[model samples]
Every structure is written in structure tokens, then in C-alpha cells.
Target: MAGLLQRVKSKMAIFAHRKARGMLDGEYGSVFRGRSLDFDDLRAYVPGDEVRDIDWKASARHGSPLIKRYVAVRRQTVLLVTDTGRNMAAEARSGEVKKDIAVLALGVLGYLAHRHGDLVGLVCGDSAATRSLPAKGGEAHLERLLKHVDSHANLEAAASRIQDQLHHVARNVKGRHLLFVVADEIAADAATGQLLRRLRAQHEILWLTVRDAELAPSRQAGTDPIARGDSFSVADSTFLAWQPATSAAVQAAYTKATAERDAARKAMLRGAGITEGEVAGSADVITGLFALLERHRRAG
Candidate 1:
């Protein structure tokens, strides 16, 4: 697994890319400017500490004034927030598993942050429970973060419970950071929109949706065959058996519905000042990421 991560890491040679500079606020450096604009830690006030850096509440708690120590402003934190629910277990049109895509994608982002000397963090889970790792830098820390998602984060669960996970991240992560969310396709809705907007207020959110042909039926033609082991559901109708062929009209209707659903989802993200892209299969993984980064660069 570590070897695979290293291969992906190598493909992310962002130094040649102009957008990498944008990650650090257009500075002429290769590193990402971290959450230094936000306070890092609180220590007992020092003689030369700035008065504005003093934490009054901490001072009361310790019976002496304490100073907030912010990490280097040039360093940034990259948090990978993912959902390992059942939907993630589905197979993508590229023939790679969604869970594998998620791991690789996470590896890509984590590797970029690692290369730039930025801290890497994670918040991943399903309906059962959500786990979080505070931002920390280094090869060892990045490896552990990747391993946890590869091993502990399961793919058999039901509800992704993304809203809950979002709230968890919001409450646990301190200050501003670079947040990447990898999850199933989100249907645009008020509740999720509100939560995303709130998170956007405090962090740079880059949305990644794991795409699979099975998830949204295209307008093409006959019913798409659900691979023997690949089954999915909509509402309460679970498709466990292989799918049968459908007329062109049926496929069109399905396509129309999916288009509308996708449009609404995009609209919601736009409203929240978020942009999303897809990671389809193993082959498309690296290319998709580079393309996504290009978009981020242009946006910045």
C-alpha cells in the first residue's frame, strides 16, 4: 500500500504547475501557506510576545497570561474528509472499485500536502461512526493517515451520513485549512447546502465526487448491465440481480432525471462557492486530479 501511495505521489509533480503557487497565496515559494493566519497553540506569555497574541481565557485558567503561537504562515493544513459507506463500494465504469478510487485520490491530495511540507489530516466514516485525525506533517504521519483510510474505513455500511460527518469536521477542525471531501454524488438540498456554506466560511473546500456509470444512468440506450457483484438501489428498490434491457424511452427518462439531479447538485455547490470534479478509475485517477488542480489554479 505504501508503495502504491509513493507511485501516486510521484505523479503529483506540482512544482512545474503555476497553480501550486496559488496554494501559497501567490508567494514565490513551492510550499502551501498554512493555517498560520489562525492561531496554532497557547503557551505561557513570554517577555517579547505581542500583546494581541495573549489568550485572556487561557491566562485565567493558568493564573497567568498565555501567548498564542501560530505555526509558520507559509505552511498549510490539508484535511481529507471522506465517506466509506456502501455507495463507495460500488464499481466504477472504469472497472476500478470506488473504495480504491477514494484511497488513491486521498493519497494524491495527502501526497501533495506532504510534498509541500503542509500538515495532513483526515475525517472519514459512515453511519456507524466518524473518526478524525488532527493536522500533522511528515512522511510517517501521512502514511498513517493513508493506512487508516485503507484499513479502518469500511465499505459495507448503508447511509453515508455526510451531513453528520460535515458537522463533525466543523466542530473538530480548528481554524482555516485546505479541506478535500471525497464522497458519493450529492443530491442538492437545503440542509447539506447550509452545512457546506458554513464550512466554506472557514476553509477552502475542494469537492471530489467518486463517479461510476452505475450511479447515474446516461441517456445512451439499453439498460446498463449491473456487474454480477455490482448492485445498487434507488428509494427502496434494490437491484441485486443482473439488469435487463430497457427501451430507448426508459433510458431517456432515467437520463433526464439524472441530469436534473446533477444540475441541482452543481447549483448548490456553486451557491456555496464550491466546485466539484470526479475521479473515475485507476487510469483516470492521476489525470483527473491534475485537471482538477488546473481548475483550482484557474479559480485561484
Candidate 2:
């Protein structure tokens, strides 16, 4: 498992490096200037405009033209919050776990934001929160953030809640920023809804939902149960299983329950005014993420 994780990290680093380079080259609509703009485009001097911005040399060269110079704007910060709760460990089908997908998504976003000259921070939590890294800029900062995410191995306790931690995050972030959340689309309780509403008013919030295909379909039909002699590992130890469910009806019931859960989760996310991207295992995270960013950029 450790080796697999290392391989995933290496691949992600290469992808992020390439993506960040393209972004830094100033793609159309990319935020080159920060949120606070000191300067804008040069335009012909108007009668009411301030005289200090006029470019005398350009005006002389143009004979009758009046040129005004503008300064660049301040940049916006981006915060990425990832849930490392036990729920994230849930398997989807026979592929990568939700936790793995979340890590990759966060890594890409962190790199992209850093490349775009946005200060980036990470908040990891379940019921309680841990601030792994504060908002900072540059490639070195991004690399450090990725390393922290990679070294994170602890899982949240069962029944851990996210609402309180989210609220805390909202309060601690001093300025308006882009908040990207990676988690499962679990039902949003009242507290969760309130926290989201408060944060949305001040920041642009995007939700990346990691889900297992098996959880969506809810059934494993026609698969033979493991025999008594078969061994499997739970936690860090191997153990033999005496029996496993093999009934088709049982699988069908599980499937129905999972479908209902997924529906409810989607509805809840919509109500919270958050757009969700569902990811299963290592399925094309970059494509979905890029599409979302493009949509947001267009809208802004």
C-alpha cells in the first residue's frame, strides 16, 4: 500500500508541475493580478481622469495621443479543506479508496493555485480540525504542502462530524478566498447547512465528492464468499474468515440501500448551494477538476 501511494504521489507531482507551468504562462482569464488591483490597462486620458497616469513620452510619440499607465492588482488566496475521516476509507468497487482520490485532487488544486500566485492553505479534519499548513505562495510552499498531505496517515474516529470544523475554518480565514472542499456527499445536518451558508457568503466554495462505485450500485452479486481457510487483513493483521454473505437477496437489499443513500446525499449537496464532482477511485480527476475550474472562471 505504501509503495502504491508513493507511485500515485510521483505521478501527481509530474502532472501538477506541467499544469502549473501552463497556468503560470498566463492563460486567458487567468488571475495574474491579485484581488486588489493597483493598475489596469492604459487608455486615452479623459478630461476628468487624473493627470499623474499620463505617459508623456508615449503622448509625444503619438503626436495627439494621451497614454495612461495602470498598476497590477493584489491576488486572492485559496484554501483547500480535505476530510480524512473514517468515511473516506470506504471502498468503491475494487479500485483506489476515496481517501486516495481526495489526496490527489487536493494536491492538484494546491499546485494550480500556487502556480497562479494565490496563497494556499490546507485544513484537514473530521469532527475536530488540524491546520496542516497556512496560506503561502511559491513552488517551495506548494511542495511542502504536498509533503504534509502525503505524510498524513491518521484517520478520524468513527462518527466524526465536519460541521464544527468547517465553521471554524470559515472564521479563521481572514480574507475572501476560494474554498475547495474534498469529502463524501454525506447528508448535511442543520449545523453543516448553516456553516456552508456562512462560508459561501464570503468565499467561492467548490465541493469534490469522492464516492465508491460499489457504494453507488450497492451490491456484489454472483461473487463467491470466501472459504473458512481464506485469509484477509483488517487493521494491520491477517485473519481467517469463517463465513461471508453469499445470498443474492442480501446483495440486492444492500444495493437498494446504497442507491437511496446516494440520492439523499446529492439532494443535500444541492440544497447547500455547492456543486459536487463525484470521483470513483483514480478515475480522471484532472479532467473533472479542470472542467469545474473553467466553469467557475467563465462565470466569474
Candidate 3:
């Protein structure tokens, strides 16, 4: 476990570097959630109070300076929910399986949680079954959590159960925490949206979608047909068939449908107040994680 932690954290060393803001060192907010200060309330200004906390306008209205008080809640819970269905087991353009990419993303964030003194947990499984590690803080505990996620136990499910995992987390988790939902491209099923809405109302959610090159057929013009003897891909694999669209018009229609689907998915996610991070099949996990943290840092 120590060795695995060292290996994965080494890959993320760039992200964990000391910055002027010193977020990782806790001088400012930890990288997970922006600033660490949680606003408590306003009160009469007292001597020795930090000038930045004074609400000048409020003080003018009330004829006295007021200071904003913040209580520190240093520890946070970061729960990772990963989909382990067979689709994730398929090869990515990088030649690594989508599941492996998903695990890399998980490790990057899990280690970040540990760095920030946050409790990390895992909820990984597919349609068949699920396993969870209760949120705990520690290098050893985090390594264990990562190991559980890296296991094949959840990857053997016969079908995708992303929605099932979402539902489980929504029902089981309580209070404010960070939830990372890792899956292939967003299918945006009805239940998924509804469950996400409910979960967002409780926990802060970030969606990390792993995209294998094969997911987008239009981009695979240079790639071979689905298979030599097979016209249609296997039920669980990429659905693209070797045959081209019946006609130019049919191809155009398919393209339009695909575009519309992508647009709708983005719109739905926006409405849910959830920002998404996408990692290419072959992209470096550390680089992908830095991009996600930058976006999150700005937004938070």
C-alpha cells in the first residue's frame, strides 16, 4: 500500500507542488474546495479583528463596524463513485483500458484529499454489486481506499450501473462532502439527472467522464471497421458497425443527432450545477487532474 501511494503520488507531484497561494500547505484554501474559511456570521467589530473581515457598508448603516466571523471546518469528506461496467474494460486509444484511466483519475483526487487532510472513501461497482469504504483520513487508509477501487471486483458487472451507483451514494451519504462520479461519456439517463439533482442538493458533485477514442465514431474515420467478420459490434462494446450510413442524408442525420445529444448533455449538467472534467483515453492523468483543479479553483 505504501509503495502504491508513492507511485501514484509521484505522478501527481506537479499538482502537489508548493504554490504562492500555498493551498496544499493549508495557508489558503485546500485545492479541493477553494478557501478553507466557512463563513459563520456577522458580529460587532472587536479590537484585534482582522480588517479584511469588517463589513464597511454594514458598519456605516448600523453606526458601528461589523466583523464577519468564520469557523474552521478543516476536514472534508471526498467520496469517489466509479462505474465498473464492462464498457470501461474496453481498450482506449491510448491502449490502456478506460477503467485504468478512471482509476488514475481516482488516485489523483484521492491523494489530493489526503494531502488536504480530508477523509476519502470509495463506492465502486456495476450492475451486479457494489463495495464501499467509509471515509477515513490517513496515508495508509487512502492507499487502502485506492486499492479497493483499483480492484476488479466491481469491473465484472455484466452491464453499466452508473445510475445505480449514483442512487446508492445519494441515499447513503449525508451532509456536505465532495462527490466524484467517474464514468464513460455522459449518457444522461433520466434517473441519473434526477438522482444527481438530489445529491447536488446535499453534497458538492464533480463529474469526471473518461472518453475512449472509440466512443466517437465520427472521429474514427481512419480506424478499421468494427471487426473483419462482424458487421455490428458486440452488444457490450462500441456500437458502431462496419457499414457506413445508408446514404449521405442518413449520415448527416446521424451527425445531427449526435450533436444534439452532446448539447443536451451539457445543458443538463449545467442546470444541475455540476461542472464536468473530461480526460482523453491516452492523456496524462496528472495533466488532466491539473486542468480539473484549475477550473475548480477558479469557480470555487
By TM-score, the best candidate is: 3
State the number of backbone clashes in model 3. Answer: 0
Which candidate has the highest lDDT of all?
A: 1
- On lDDT, the stronger of 1 and 3 is 1
Q: TM-score of model 3 relative to the true fold?
A: 0.73
Stretches of candidate 1 exceeding 4 Å from the true structure: 1-4, 10-72, 153-155, 215-237, 241-244
C-alpha lDDT values of all predictions: 0.71, 0.62, 0.69
Which lDDT tens digits does candidate 1 get at residues 173-270?
A: 88787788988777888998999999999888788887755533333434554433435552233764433323566567767887898889889988
**Model 2 lDDT, residue 183, Cα:** 74
**Every model: Cα RMSD to truth:** 7.8, 8.8, 5.5
1 versus 2: better TM-score goes to: 1
Q: By summed lDDT, which 10 consecutive residues of candidate 1 come out lowest?
A: 25-34
How good is model 1 by TM-score?
0.72
TM-score of each: 0.72, 0.66, 0.73
Give the candidate order by descending TM-score: 3, 1, 2
